[model samples]
Target: MIGIIGGSGVYRAEMLEDCKKEEIATPYGRVSLTVGSFDGKKIAFIARHGEKHSVPPHMVNYRAHIKAFEILGVERVIATAAVGSLRDDYVPGNIVVPDQFIDFTKKREYTFYDREAVHISMADPFCDEMRAISFKVLKDFEHKEKGTYVCIEGPRFSTRAESRMFKSFGDIIGMTLVPECQLARELGMCYLCLAMVTDYDVYGEKPVSNVDVKRVMAENIERIQRVIEQMLKELPEGRSCRCSRALEEAR
Candidate 1:
């Protein structure tokens, strides 16, 4: 089955058919998601934030959510995150399929192997096959095929100095994607992040605002939905990437 994790401004998967609410109880906590079908393919969707946007980025239960997907027998996951642009060219309303990520987040449960020392390879974090599909799907829209994401701990936007420092190496900024992406790899699930640029970071002339971010995402929500639908449809039945073999090499 394919899993879809909807971030801010995305509350539901409108394309789904015969949807039903499911509550999964994991070791970490319980996760509520929707199980539905699109084009006869099984799909499970969970809003990263609550349905009403109640959960903050830092407070999200990443482990439980991923665990729930595993329990539901999901193998591939497509997640969307609203991010602030660090570069002038990665404008608002643009989409970025991040090829890399920098974790600046603190105080989050980033792993599932707390009982053992399991060092997993993260040299290439995202699934190459999924990224290739995304690149093709994004061709009809304004997007960047490659970019680095800077994941910060928040409910708060970055300070100008912090934003500038992140800009040195990262292309986009957001509050999630650290532990969530890594945790998926631990379970050998193919994960892809479809990062949408909602506004410019504080490093830009205008300070980022919640209102503006919401406005931008609301306007571009349909674009993201379409990309996700297309990617799901294009994916082959069998996995061809190394994502599923992640744990075999971990020590």
Candidate 2:
């Protein structure tokens, strides 16, 4: 089964049919997710920031979220995030499938194996196979294929100085992807991020006057939805990648 993690303006996928809400419990905690079927395939969807958008990025229970998917028999996760563009090439209302991630987030539980001290390799954070699948679906849309995403710790947007520093290091910036991505890896689940470019950050000389969050999200909402819809339709029937085999060395 496939899992979808919704972020920002995306709280739900309208295409999901026969949707039912599920409350799941894991060793970490309990998480609520929506389950439904699309094209005869079972899918699970979770709103990362909660259904009400009440939780901030730093406060998200990353472990519980991934655990919910795991317990539900989900094999792959497609995470969507609203990000700030560090480069002009990726303007507002654009979509990017990041090939790499630099985690600047602090104070979040990054792993599940605390007692056993398991070390999962994270040299390539996002699953390449899942990313490739996402890329193939996104190719039909007007979006960037590959870029580096910098995940920061935040309920606040970056300052001008911070934005510039990030631009020097990566192509895009966002919060909430760090522990989410890392935790999924520890669970041996394939993960892919569909980062939606929502703003230029404070680095842009536009004075940061009127970057309307609602407006930007409204403008790109349909395109983002479309990409995910296409991705669901094209998702492979069985795992042909190493993501499902990630836990072979866990013991």
Candidate 3:
């Protein structure tokens, strides 16, 4: 089954007919999930920010969410995130399927391999197979197919100086994505992050603020919802990539 992870508004479980909620327990913690059929295909949908958007980015249980999908037999996961733009090329209201990620998250549990030493290769953080499929579905829109996302540890927005420093390293800025991306790979699941630019961080004339981020998210989430719906309908029956074998050589 294909898994879709996003905010409550972006990935609606009510959109599915005969929907049912299921909770799974992982070694890390518990993950609440909803499973139903969309377009006659079985799909597992979960909110990245908890059911009511109560969890902050830094407090999210990345391990539990990804592990729940793995235990439930999901082959691939498509995640939608609201991020801040660090580059002039990517502006608010634009969508981007991040091809790479830079982990700057300081105080979050980043791996499931605490007991064992597993050196996993992260040459490409996001799944190439899913990225290709996302491009096809969002071709009509002005979206970026490739960009580097810098993940920060935050319940707070970035300062002007910190934001400026990150501009040199990445194309976008966000508070999540680190452990979520890595954990999926460790479990041999195909993961893709579909990011929506929500603000210009501190790079813009006005320093980034929660108000602006929420405003931009409100404007662009519907568009993301439509794009994701179409992508789910067009996914191939089999994935032809190395995402599923990520643990083969590493373990």
Best by TM-score: 1
- Pairs that collide in candidate 3 are none
Q: Which digits, one per residue and each the tens of the lDDT, describe model 1 over residues 151-239?
A: 99988999888988999999999998988999999999999999999988897778999998999999999999999999989999899
For model 3, the stretches where C-alpha displacement exceeds 4 angstroms are 8-14
Candidates ranked, most accurate by TM-score first: 1, 3, 2
- Between candidates 1 and 2, the one scoring higher on TM-score is 1
Superposed by TM-score, candidate 2 places the C-alpha of residue 219 at a distance from the truth, in angstroms, of 1.5
Instruction: Point out the higher-scoring one by TM-score: 2 or 3.
Output: 3
Clashing pairs in 1: none
Across 110-181, the per-residue lDDT of candidate 3 in tens digits comes to 788888878788998888888888889998887999889999998788888899899998999888888888
Q: Give residue 136's error in model 1 in angstroms.
A: 0.9
Give per-candidate clash totals.
Answer: 0, 0, 0
Off by over 4 Å in 2: 207-211, 249-251
User: For model 2, how does the per-residue alpha-carbon lDDT over 27-55 read when each residue is reduced to its tens digit?
Assistant: 88999889999989899999998888899
> Which one wins on lDDT?
1
- Computed on alpha carbons, the lDDT of every model, listed in order, comes to 0.93, 0.85, 0.85
